[model samples]
Target: MKLEHVSKTIRHKVLFDDISFQIHKGLYRLTGKNGSGKSTLIRLLSGLSAFDNEKRLKLEGDVLFLDLNPIGLAPFSIKDNFYLLCKTYQVKLTPELEANVEAFFSDSYNDDYLHASVGTKLKLGLSLLLVKEWDYIFIDETLSTIDNDSLKIVAKQLVKLSKTSTIIYVFHNLSCLLLEQNSRILHIEGGKVREV
Candidate 1:
């Protein structure tokens, strides 16, 4: 997605201004200090929240924002969550898709399946980027629980998924997410984004 002159303001507070950036169809890491408007920018881009009057938000293609909270509802396993996500997107969940679900969840973790740990639950969420084929995917600092090995796998999956898509990932650990040097990094500070 391409953003030009996008800014957000609340009351008398100015979040950011004249924020213009062009992101290619690849993985991007958004890193910033605490309370740096990282989450706010993610919300604005994902359509979860609206930008203030001064900011202009625009998207060149499809986008989906994955929520940060990993705590899903009861009676909803990894399998069930994928099913519901596919259904909500009006996509057909075929047998092959189900098998991909199992493989993605199991392979990301070394476990035989997705019932391994709380981290796996996070992996389940990451798996959504691959399953739904969204043109743009926004992950809001959601990989905190993800470990090294799983992170490598997830990173690879993200790259593969981005072959025909764009990913705006918010990560605290820049090194982990930057395994692929080609990925762009954006730092948010004082309620503004700057490339670093």
Candidate 2:
């Protein structure tokens, strides 16, 4: 997919200025310093945000974006929230999905999901990424604060998911996992995008 001649501005300041790039199917690590336009560019590339189009915008896909806190209600039981998420995504609930959720939630499937730690909740959400099909998956610093074990599991799932979808992991800093995994790098700086 290519983003050609795209510009993004918020509050009269342009974060990205008429940038263009093409990337193919695979895992990509998007790196930039803080306050750079990495997340904005990811949103634009995911087709979640509209940009100033010097040419007609090009990127298109079913996109899943994980930005740390997932879409679980604080008052909802883990099972209810999981079911809600599946319903929201139109994923047919199956035995395999149930088993995965059970594993993620452990013995607390009936308890309010927010009662569990953040890492556990993140695992529950990431599990569904394995169950669903999508064209693009944008992870914006979702793994930065998770436990090491959860990070390892989510990284494995992401690597597996990249076989069929364009996975973009966005963070400000380089990660060992991103380097070791079969992933390419895209860095943003000074309102421009480039492969590094």
Candidate 3:
């Protein structure tokens, strides 16, 4: 996928200007200081937000975006949410898949996901997304709230997913987890992007 001459302006300030880059199949770490347009760029790339030069963007295959606080997971049990997500994606909800999801959350399967802790809810949502098929996955600060153990598990899942899918992760801190060897790190500063 490629973004050419992309620019985003919010209010009266320009967040990013005429940025161009190509994304390949692998893990990518996107980092920048606060208000550097890191999240804005990810939103544009994932199609969650439209840019001024929308026609110049070229994207191939399915793209999935996971936000820090995912909506729609609330107001339902973990099992119900899993089934709902599967149906929404047109993925078959097999017995084995259900069993695996249950094991992922362990005793939290039958509990109300909305009432669960932030970390638990994040893990639950991520576990569901990990099983789905997508060519490109963009994660926006979703792992920042989890515990060290859960973070380790999520990191392992991310490394495994990178083998078959392109992963773009946005993080404010760099020492969160060790990225894969082939992962690329991009720094966005002053509305420009460069590999660091």
Candidate 4:
């Protein structure tokens, strides 16, 4: 994916100007200070925002935008949500695979369905993403909520994704993960993006 001459303005001020970058096939971390418009850029690229003025967001091929708010609610049960997600992505989960989802999220705090808590819901969403195929995946600061074991699973999944899909993640915790430092880092300050 390449964003060429992309600019976003709000309230008569440009948040970012001519922000251009290309993400090759690999895991690239979008690192910058808070309020740098990182989230804005992610949302724009994900086609969830109309904030860009230049409208130069270009995607080469298939892209799966997985933000922190993974699954949208429809007043459905956990099983229904999981099945819907699978159907939307055209993925087939076997009976054993479905059982593991229940097993993975079961806890005393959670009900037998594992849909009682927000944490469990997030877990379900993460689990759903593991088996899907895509060309690119964008994750915006959602990994921090995962527990230790889940974090390990996420890291391994990301590494596996690097082989096929380009993974662009906006992360604050750069200490625990492995990524290429040569990747672009945009520093947002005072409503402007400066290459760092």
Q: Which 10-residue window of candidate 2 scores lowest in summed lDDT?
A: 52-61
Model 2, TM vs. native: 0.86
- Candidate 1 lDDT, 71-96, residue by residue in tens: 44445565666666666677666677
TM-scores of all predicted structures: 0.78, 0.86, 0.87, 0.77
**Tens-digit lDDT track for model 4 on 1-196?**
6666767887777877766665568766776677667888777866667656645455666567765664745466666777777888777888887776665555521343333565556666677656665687777877766676666666677777778877777768754544433334555666544455
Residue 93's C-alpha lDDT in candidate 1?
63
**What C-alpha lDDT values do all the predictions have?**
0.68, 0.75, 0.75, 0.66
RMSD of each: 3.8, 2.5, 2.2, 3.6
lDDT of 1: 0.68
> Once all C-alphas are superposed, what RMSD does model 4 give against the true structure?
3.6
Instruction: Give the per-residue Cα lDDT of candidate 1 at 139.
Output: 88
The positional error of residue 186 in candidate 2, measured at the CA in angstroms, is 0.4
- Return the TM-score for candidate 3, rounded to 2 decimals: 0.87
User: After TM-score superposition, what is the CA distance of residue 151 in candidate 1 from its true location, in Å?
Assistant: 2.0
Tens digits of per-residue lDDT for model 3, 1-196? 7877878888879888888888777789898888888888888878778887554344677677787875447689877777787777777667777776777777887889778777777776677554666788888988787677666666777777788888898866544445545468888988898877
lDDT of 3 at 134: 74
Instruction: Give lDDT tens digits, candidate 2, residues 1-196.
Output: 8776778888888898878788888889988888887777777777667786533344465678787766688788778888888888888878976886676555777877878777667765676775787788888877776666556666777787788789898755545564355778898889998988
Candidate 3 backbone collisions, by pair: none
